[model samples]
Target: MPASPDRLPLALYRAAQVRALDARLIAAGTPGFELMQRAAQAAWRALRRRWPQAGELCVLAGRGNNAGDGYLIALLAQRAGWRVRVLAVGDPAQLVGDAARAHAEARAGRVRIEPWSECAPLSGVLVDALLGTGLSGPVREPFAQAIRLINASGLPVLAVDIPSGLCADSGRVLGEAVRAELTVTFVGLKLGLFSLDGPDRCGALRFADLQGAAPLPAGEPPAAWRLAGERLPTLAARPRNVHKGQLGHALVVGGDTGFGGAALLAAESALRGGAGLVSLATREEHVAAALARRPEVMARGVRSANQIQELAATADVLVLGPGCGQGAWARSLLGGLGALDKPQVWDADALNLLAAGALAAPRGRWLATPHPGEAARLLGCSTAEVQADRAAAALELARCLNAVVVLKGLGSLIASPDGTLHLCDHGHPAMAGAGLGDVLAGLLGALLAQGLEPEAAARLGVWLHARAGERLGGAGRGLAAADLIEDIRHLLEEHSPCLN
Candidate 1:
């Protein structure tokens, strides 16, 4: 969240592709060794800025250009009279091109380079330059041993480029990845760095445009663009003449007899997210408590389709299914609203009903907010399958359903029916609690009422929700659905929307 998503372009690159670009740069007049030196300087500068007083450098080196960067770092630290050691995991002589030159330079600078061992004392800041991004499959033998050692060392690590064992394309850890305190990536930003295991492995991220004056050839975007608060358009300040009706009425239809709390929360979130005249069409049972909780919301007790008709007809938006169970009553209620004309948000058991062929979305502009399990069921695939490539899965679902698909998970990818994909890279582990999806659905519904496009609403609302979760995630752990409403309002107000 520290870096705006817009700061990094939508383009992404694989390890081989970047490496090829590096070679092309060398071929295009920039000396390969000069690029290596520039990279080393960049890493060193970032390392110093991140940890100003940390004097020692424990550089983990492999036989590739990444290790070359580490070796050059060791040389710089050694020349600066700081304690520096190169824990070589592979044969340094096997290093070719600028990497070999770096190894020679490190040796020339009288820097200590020794064969790596698990027992090697890691006293200072660790530098992970071992596997790099070109690596795939399992981390074999020595490198694996080194990664295990680094993890056990519990040292604050500065990973060079992508983490040692992380895949730049998909972010699937290849066996294991270095847990870095700060990852300084170079040139083109790797899309995987912000998604999946990428987020967990990359602690504090910093990007450096190593290409300098040269620009590389463009390639197909990885899958989606990162969703940040900067991407949302500024909501004009409410007019002095603004009325509850003018802002757009959103009717929340859900909450069966037993699960009224879910419906209440959705209505509450809709109101908080700036929907004017938020109404709840729930069971007659929970009306009093919802009224007591937030009297601003019009709590309507509806038993049949006749009751929902007026609300649905008048409201600009409809948020369907929070605690709406897949029971006969829930189906009967939704079936009645099937022909109604309104921009809708379908979620939870409503998605389940869609999968079961019991419910059909009244098309125009709609959003479906589905967590992994719900998404799997909707796509007729296992959760693992949906997560393997979340970007692809989200895009497929959006295209098939002809609605904005918010496939929520670690990365929280949002895909539009027209093939635009955006990734919401915020949110914390604490958000894994129940009722969060319903909150997001309601938030998006409110955004729709506010007149943001369906895709923009999904992207902006999700980013705000995730930012709230992160802000509230303290060292104490665990978060409730209701815990985020205030933070959501604060973030929405402060989020300037348009990217600079």
Candidate 2:
């Protein structure tokens, strides 16, 4: 994900919303051509800052306002005494409205403009103005070839508004998309720029609300919100007289046979995440290890569903299915928990079992955290379908299960039963490993047990987990799952201090 500055807009809009806002700005007296000029200026400033020493420029121009921005940028470069060339990918004569006007301005300024050719030399910074947010279908012909050539050229690319051929709503690549080193977006923040393929294609994002567009009109709500520390819910300072019984007890149930560590990891995470008390119910063989590793948790060895009933009866929240296999033991544990009405955090094999129809979805306040593969299984779709529009998948999961859903991925999405969505743009690729999901499930359970609503708990837990992964991921690769627990605890205290 791009490094977000504190001043960037938090609301995420779809392509249509951004366009509507653009139209609104135009209606409010700012001419479309003027806005296009502002976009060009923004791109020019960002380009100069990023590549000040690169005096030569090459711009790939299309037929839309995006191309207009490119043309104006080329003119700006020419006026600045920098050698610049505009490669018109679309017919220059076919340019319409403000785009045509921009072409005329570039021509009047004696800016070098020529038809795109395969032999065009990609020099200095390459400006991608091929397609914009208006693109809806797969890229075709010369544009696709041009994007490929630019990518292959290994030049520092600056994209206008959004990278060409990327879906502005879904962040999906349309056949092919430009990979930009920096992207200068305009108006409202596009939803695609921070999710899915957006993060990979847009290296660093800079926003400029050209024309100083007013707040969105009534009834024009953002598609989702970017999760940030300032926007997240914080826990209140604890009372000095608080006792273990005052805070909720969290029970972690899993670890069938060979997967004892998964359950232990969850239990340990819950204990460290500020849960008043944490208890572990797993296979008998793992009890000694669990007790030795974390004596604070009341670890119990359970052999059957009947044995788990007593443990479940006393717990305030349940963290189920870390390393829980699809055998009889896992099924029995689910069945035992099914009779209770406590808040629950279900993950791993629990999600698998629910997808397989072996266990019913929980009826109480619950949060379901599933990766794309598991989400695909739960939704009865392919993983590609889930990744294509992760927000939709997450919303569907929340609606179907009537639970808060955390769709874990590059931009982790949290969907509420009310249809609201939030995206966590934190985390690092190095955190991709076994046991992270288990730790998240435990963290969610702890937050719930500490009295946060299901949605609040999911949001805070996901953010903490991803942010911790990002901090530890700086070391680059080989990040263990256990490495995140301490960071999460520390971050929680920092964000929601005990004495603040």
Candidate 3:
């Protein structure tokens, strides 16, 4: 919660995994009730630090262990002399196991407990303890109504473990979900918290290993990992006598007719991203503009696929798509690309063409970067289906296309051909603009051309692009696609410097 660099959790788990870890801890030594108490203490500490001046506390509680943690938090608050009240959404009398014990303890501590109602007055910080990760179906009546009320309460909210009604496995909003300003999770980080609707609902995530349950056992790999500076691939410093040829050449193919700027952006980004030599093969009308804007790029106007073949033959890597219209010319160019034996980064209309079955899937090394809509089309599903389970969609895409897939969105997911997944939690809202994906495609191509494997290039490129967007997005709205080029170069140098 407090942006302490060292405290961030790197590994992420599914709801079932976290639950298993909890059970393991309890079985080893710690009691379930004791764990619940520790969770409460952790949440209380975070709540105090976040809203220290606020003396009143209102907790919305349900009937699971999640509600048990809420009851314990209420007890702690009351003991600390803070005004505390617990509105029980689930029948308190029916509470069992650790939850019942916790409720008894809250009553013993003189914490006011009352049944929840639509008319219940909400004041001060609201604590959501209504549901936990076990939820798999759509939120039911009263709980749904309570979550809606919580959202409309205009009160700062602190969620226990996870926000109520949000799927811990997929981060999907099941009919509805509570939007918490801050959430305190225990044991391990949930996969859902960083993707889909998770990032939006879980405002600021705080992890506390109450039982020191991390450093999980061997052979139990996480569903995915959060991309951080330490985990990033290094582009180690180049030698003094290095030649341009050693760095590898990158060819950017696209920019059909009116969409030439997209190809130009990718070429320029590739050059800035450390590609040794960048070449642009676009429509004749756009070649002059590409050369004028970025004279360093070897811009060539190609009227037919045969002309592009000549350029492709000399290139080490190809960055395909980016404003490539799905017209006759675009089809002709894509058809010619199948014969080339080069690593390719396909994006934009290229992805659309692939989805429409107009272009054959590349047999050689390739990486596909697709937004939700493009991903939906590629998988023969709807955008909502792709969004509902982004990880699944990305992995499926990678397998189906036999290429690394970068599913670009709020929390972009990079899925390797072998099914390994990584997530980038960087970037900002201002980055939701045109041409950014083109920039990313170019950057990915540059990284690949520079000798990084497709998987590594995708992971590193996504991180660099997102990090640059975050830096520029601080200036508020209107972050153009080209604005990230310079910043990305700087970030790349800092993260994977050309000189030590």
Model 3 vs. true fold: TM: 0.97
Model 1 lDDT tens row, 136-183: 688898898888888888888999998888878667788888888888
- What lDDT is obtained when candidate 1 is compared to the true structure? 0.83
* TM-score of every model versus the real structure: 0.89, 0.97, 0.97
Residue by residue across 1-500, what tens digits does model 3's lDDT show? Answer: 11225476777788888888888888788899888989999999999999999999999999999999999999999999999999999999889999999999999999999999999999999999999999999999899999999999999999999999999988999998999999999888899988878989999989888956434556777788888876789887999999999998999999987888899899999999999999999888998898789999999988788888889999999998998899998898777786578999999989999899898888899999999999999999999999988989999999999999999998899998787999888999999988999999999999998999999999899999999999999999999999999999999988987876
Candidate 1 vs. true structure, TM-score:
0.89
TM-score for candidate 2, residues paired by index? 0.97
Name the weakest run of 10 consecutive residues (lDDT summed) in model 3. Answer: 1-10
Q: Work out how many backbone clashes candidate 2 has.
A: 0
- In angstroms, how far off is 456's CA in candidate 2? 0.7
Q: Count the backbone clashes (under 3 Å) in each candidate.
A: 1, 0, 0
Q: After superposition, how far is residue 345 of candidate 1 from its true place, in Å?
A: 1.2
